[model samples]
Target: MSVDVPRRIVIFRHAKADWSQESDHERPLAERGRRDAPAAGRWLASAGIAPELTLCSSAVRTRETWKLAVHELPQRPRTVYEDRMYEASLGELIALVNETAEDVNELLLVGHNPGMHALADALAGDAEGDALARMNRAGFPTAAIAVLTFQGTWKSVEHGVGRLTAYWSPQE
Candidate 1:
């Protein structure tokens, strides 16, 4: 299939969670995280990057992050929740992106890290700034977003083929 180049994908790691809680999966966003969400959303909007579809982990923090971020975007359909996204690996996340409908040009995936960071590093080709290195060093912070561009279908995206377009963090 001759897919178009420059397909955009945005990956966001869920905001900070309330560690006081017991289970990691059930932890909600911390107050700072709650505050950071809208800021991150605004940053995305300011950059004119909006997702046509949002795929988020069903975890509390992930859902909350999505709700906050989508608020900055134009009206659209509800997000797709994937249970597998809760603690999915980079490979799993890539597979999920590949499964997205071909009609959708832009997509956003919000989930947790190690996986998110790994995916970013995997898809990124010659990351220019300190962003990718910072991401690798500290892990994706709460309310951080990485934008990538692929030259073919998501299924066809491979290492070094996806370009790192941008990276946004709440702290900066």
Candidate 2:
């Protein structure tokens, strides 16, 4: 099979939601989350990590978080809303990534966790000791970004096949 290696896949969980809201999926980002989203975006921009495509969950919080982050991106990428990403499982998330258009070299997925956290752990290979330990200590926080590299095409991305390039959390 021809390998269509994706240089990087950045997964971001929506920022913290207002718990006082009734509907979990509809909850908007909390005040703290709003502030942190831009900070995280700045970090990505400063690092020269820009995505070619953005796949975001349809949930309000996730959408809002994506909006905040995209502002800091050096260039705006094409975006698509995927409802399945709202509460997807690790396997489902992988499938979504694999389904991305082949021409897109870098992809960003903005969704929720523990699916995001689980996917990170499942795909990461040879992660830095400090990063692995930190990921294990705390499930990915809202507004956290996990950068993973895959050797083969996005269509062939499988569990345990990616290297953790970097991880960024708001608290860090």
Candidate 3:
């Protein structure tokens, strides 16, 4: 992709997970999460936000969310199950994004909060209408996805470099 072309980043928080599991990383999605996951996928499809690559956390809940969400897309993008993303800090998450290949125009990150929320807030220096406000109000709930656009190579992605174009939640 040309450096002049805007790159889109879809920051997706994993769906609500079942709390009964002994291991946090092994917990599966709850019934509501199962339903909400597909809704998020449908929204992405309707908005035509097809990512070229997806960097997903290896946690079972996040992986399950990706499985359901990707099913709604026109084509399945390349996906990497990254264990580091399970509970990555904002800086670590940024580093992961920076390592993205230049050829990928759009990238999706399936992970958890508050890293996901922090990344979205930090990157969006500006917003389209009330996108940022609504995101704040929603508190980046489970299965929420924030769409951001920035102009530059993935290596250049940093704080205040992106515009928050859209935000969506299962309740919405």
Which prediction has the highest lDDT against the true structure? 3
- Estimate, for each residue in 113-159, the C-alpha lDDT of model 3 and write its tens digit: 99999999999999999999999998999999999999999999999
Instruction: Give lDDT tens digits, candidate 1, residues 58-117.
Output: 888899887887787756545898899998987888889889877777888899888888
Q: Tell me the RMSD of model 3 versus the true structure.
A: 1.0
lDDT of each: 0.82, 0.84, 0.95
Worst 10 residues of 2 by lDDT: 1-10
Q: lDDT score of model 2?
A: 0.84
Locate the minimum summed-lDDT window of 10 residues in model 3: 1-10
Scored against the true structure, residue 38 in model 2 reaches a CA lDDT of 85
Q: Could you give me the TM-score of model 1 versus the true structure? A: 0.91
TM-score of each: 0.91, 0.94, 0.97
Ranking by TM-score: 3, 2, 1
Off by over 4 Å in 1: 128-130
